[model samples]
Target: MSWGIEIYEKGMPIKITGRSFIFDQIAVTQNGSKTYNNIPKGRSLAAYIVARNRGSYFTVKVENNKISWNSLRGSQSINGIIMVLIK
Candidate 1:
């Protein structure tokens, strides 16, 4: 995961939002595999978890504003693409 203030979706090319985190020293892991390094976990505005499927490329964006991790059902997915936004 990269860090700064901008986050981009894989293959999308465009940043997700103005508050997206785009940094050079962030740690990103996929399917339990480390993908990036030194990810910031203490930023108040930073997203704690950003998960993207390697196969389908579906992305999950989780911010730190909320105090709960909502549940998502696998059946809710469309085209096997499931994107979860947690806050």
Candidate 2:
């Protein structure tokens, strides 16, 4: 398995490629409440939010070979690490 860190802006798409099996761990920061969509395809081996405030939240999503980050509130920042597995 291989891993990497990715930084993205709200509504941006990040591409991840490698072995056949892959996954991601994402942390996000937003300026307001938000909802995460399209998380990993598996059983969510694990997940959590490290931090949050009254006006901010976090979310993550993974689909196919790409991962897209979004904030329902709009205009937010996101950072996270994706772990890819090959089998």
Q: Write the per-residue lDDT of candidate 1 for residues 1-87, one digit (tens) a residue.
A: 543333355445344454543432222232221122334565443333345343333233333432222224333331222222211
Q: lDDT for every model?
A: 0.33, 0.41
Taking the tens digit of each residue's C-alpha lDDT, what string does model 2 give over 1-87? 676533334546343334233434444443322233554455332223433455554454544444444555566654433333322
Stretches off by above 4 angstroms in model 2 are 1-54, 77-87
Model 2, residue 12: distance off in Å is: 28
> Top lDDT: which candidate number?
2
* Cα lDDT for residue 38, candidate 1: 38
Candidate 1 local lDDT, residue 35: 28
Assess candidate 2 and give its TM-score to the true structure: 0.29
Give the clash total for candidate 2: 0
